[model samples]
Target: MEKLEQEMPLDPFEHIIFDYFPVYVEADVEAFLDLTSDQEKKKCTLEIVHAGMKRAAQAFNWDLQILEKVYHTIKQTGYKSIFALLKKSSPNKKYVCSIMCHHEVKRMDVYVEIKKRSGIVVKKEKLFSVKNTDEQDLLSEYGTLTWTLNHKVEFADKDYKKVYRLTFLEKDKPEDLVWKMERYEL
Candidate 1:
């Protein structure tokens, strides 16, 4: 008789965040939530988020003091709003992408814009929005965007965890982009 092999279960922290990679971090967060026991979920979530934020600060060359300020703000105001900001640096031009989640209304918004060195927004576009449900709701549809090294953005949707490569066809037109969604198991 032939021997059979069995697959092992995956570890929750296998993909822990270590830098300013929000999409992967968020995915890790989701995986952690899914795999952890209810009794330990809250504590584990806070620790993972803190670790991820620390790594992100180091990777982005942000002041460590800012992290403290951020935590203080969260404690004082509650998590009514949460956001992640990413900067794409270029020699002569700079671009920024911001993902904001409003817990009060259970909505999330994505924005990508070009900014001047002085922090003035030159042009901006709203990439997408997820509305009408809390992020933690299993039925809620949400997604994340990742900036690739090749000057392209990729979007991953929560449902089925499908990934789509976003291609900007026109330099001057943000809306003139295409999404080529490829489905595969995570």
Candidate 2:
């Protein structure tokens, strides 16, 4: 726990923006929806989402202000889906590998690009787009987004250096923004 604390400092508002990692990655939302009636499916899904959010907030001991913002964001933007990027380094830190969750929206997709470098030269690159919105254009009823062009990863672990960055791009202008970077132990 001490080393964990020293390495990857937890972000409290993570649960709000993204679904629970690993578990959500393997979750079958459609299968779960099939278990309920048409009228109850949406309701049940919302309930499950709310419950998960509440539980995550509790687990992290986040402040009320953060929770409130999360609630309002979900209320406005609607929790469409999450994009998870799992990046890991090879032994000796010479190489890196990345795995991103695949999500699809109706209209347009969000593009993601990652550049991993060992020194001055770029070592590897990973790029993809996940569709999770139906907006005709960038602007929509929900809100605008915050574009984070770069996030530096300074620390590396023993076995395989791993880090994750989650960015949210909304349609309308959102005042308070949430971006997350996390490291997982292997």
Candidate 3:
């Protein structure tokens, strides 16, 4: 994770915004010979969650302590299975974020507050939501979080085009990550 963070050429003073969401998954077992083992399903779910969190932290310039705490919280919570919409945060200096629990996953909700901000978030939106079991399963399979937006504005007879692409790999290895912003004048 440290190596990944170091590779990004982000402005130290710029505020970085990040979106957080929970992944819900279920494992069904009919018999002992069931090919889809419980452990395998759990591993897959955890990997997807971890990869997403790690990439978001890197992109938003989160502190090492914050990253550690988030990972620890997830481990404590046995991934009981729940769906949540993406929560946006404009982390600049100090902020509070949700931390999951191990026992009674839904009942043991906890929030962790951090004292420093490594980045800032510029804009936030409810990009995606998981409403039902079907959607949950679909996300669990190829659960890559991606956002693409295009906007056009006119000012004094001049036109400007803006595009933003945000992707957090859930199906691919963490080592292969490409994230950046580009500017073009028209």
Candidate 4:
């Protein structure tokens, strides 16, 4: 694993804008299975989660302590999940976007909070509510999360052309899986 890490190029800061926690968790589990000692497994899990939390804190502009608290809550809840937080800005408005995926339940939820320049949230809305279909499972056979999205989905409505198109991995199948949401205005 150290050799692999050395061979790979450094990830840019922007890469953390995507949800990669599930992949890290899955890798840690696989590594744990190969280790014979309990101490080694514990160390592996802690290292993976800590690295992930660091990236998440930078991407979300959150304090590390806050992320640790959220991680503990997720651990207590016993749900394997991935999430991303991003901030966007326009000339007149600012927004905070959140995307969360629960692999066990095969569900993903997207939300946006519209805020003023002063950082007061004015509105919150659900941008997408999606579930894994038979065609696309949230977790691949290898146990890695396989959820992704394309930001450019065409819609007849002029107000919205950026509806998301989600894709996932097909369980027990090697073919790529895709699921397009029906026309729904945001």
Candidate 5:
């Protein structure tokens, strides 16, 4: 059996703002709500989220004073950056991570093992920066990357969980932000 490591006490503010990983928590909450479609299930999910925040507080042993700093860190750093730093320090694990605009750019360094392939030859190349937030900016950044594909691969992963999909369609050579999101749920 393994014992948990001793946690250092955090200031008061840190305790309050724990578990502010909003996106994942929102997904989990949505999943719970869709599972049973009942009020009891909704209440249970809310309780679960509440308990998770409390557990995070207890794990860090934080108090009220540290909450502001904790919130700032969460707002600025995000959960992925910490994970990205750890991933970067490790050797040859076949993963790459970086920050892009307000999102995380996580890619598998291991040549994505395509079960099926795409034949569309993208004879283009583009340079991108982290500060570019506009959709047009992203398109322009990736506008020059020329990738040549020779196989028609099924885009969807054949996994049990519902997989959401998005395909970016560019109308002009400069490329526009007019991409569309299609989903199984929709």
Candidate 6:
């Protein structure tokens, strides 16, 4: 392994690697697994979620305490299980964005407050609700909670291009909508 390493690139960051069990999987190799089938889809989704979480941790340089919790949560709950990333100082940070949860299909319709622009949400619609009070307080302080969901659908709706406009009856603007993540198949 050391001999091979001498020939390989030094910067591990330049090349994305997936640490699957004991082996290192290149990004392209993992991407090839078909997620369309019933069983394969579930497994693939889990892998993607795990990879995304790891990437986020590495990118953010999250605190050791938070990182330790994330590791335990992923291991215990499994990659497909839903998880929350709570914000500490920023109220806008709290909320569940994990697509792995079953209830998310219905719950994504809700919204919360953003306190003092304390964190990273650039657009208001992009933010969603979480179980944390600080996150809710932040959202409440920024603006009242709203759900424009016709709540997006997965699998079934992946084929459609048009975004379904959802809005709260009390408001004039369509705040949210149901749509699928775009993918191109050649």
Error of 4 at 135 (Å): 17
After superposition, the stretches of candidate 2 with alpha carbons farther than 4 Å from their true spots are 1-32, 35-46, 82-186
lDDT of 6 by residue, 118-141 (tens): 343322233334343343343333
How much is the lDDT of residue 59 in candidate 5?
57
Worst ten in a row by lDDT for model 3: 149-158
Using lDDT as the measure, name the better of candidate 1 and candidate 3.
Answer: 1
lDDT: the better of candidates 2 and 5: 2
Native-referenced Cα lDDT, model 6: 0.34
C-alpha positional error of residue 94 in candidate 3 after TM-score superposition, expressed in Å: 34
Better of 3 and 5 by TM-score: 3
Candidate 4 lDDT over residue span 43-124, tens digit each: 5555566665565466567788877886677666653454433444442233222333323333465444434467654444
The TM-score, computed over Cα atoms with residue i paired to residue i, of candidate 3 is: 0.27
**Model 5: runs farther than 4 Å from truth?**
1-28, 31-51, 55-61, 77-186
Task: List per-prediction Cα lDDT, in the order shown.
Answer: 0.48, 0.39, 0.35, 0.42, 0.32, 0.34
TM-scores of the models, in the given order?
0.31, 0.26, 0.27, 0.30, 0.19, 0.24
lDDT of 3 by residue, 108-161 (tens): 221121111443322222222323335334324323222222121111111223
- Kindly list the per-residue Cα lDDT of model 1 for residues 79-98, writing each as its tens digit: 44554444454333344433
Looking at candidate 6, what is the lDDT of residue 155?
A: 18
Q: Number of clashes in every candidate structure?
A: 0, 7, 8, 0, 26, 7
Deviation in Å, model 2, residue 116 alpha carbon: 19
Candidate 4: RMSD to truth: 15.3
In model 4, state the lDDT of residue 179.
31
Model 5 vs. true fold: TM: 0.19
Q: What would the TM-score be for candidate 2 when compared with the true structure?
A: 0.26
Worst 10 residues of 4 by lDDT: 138-147
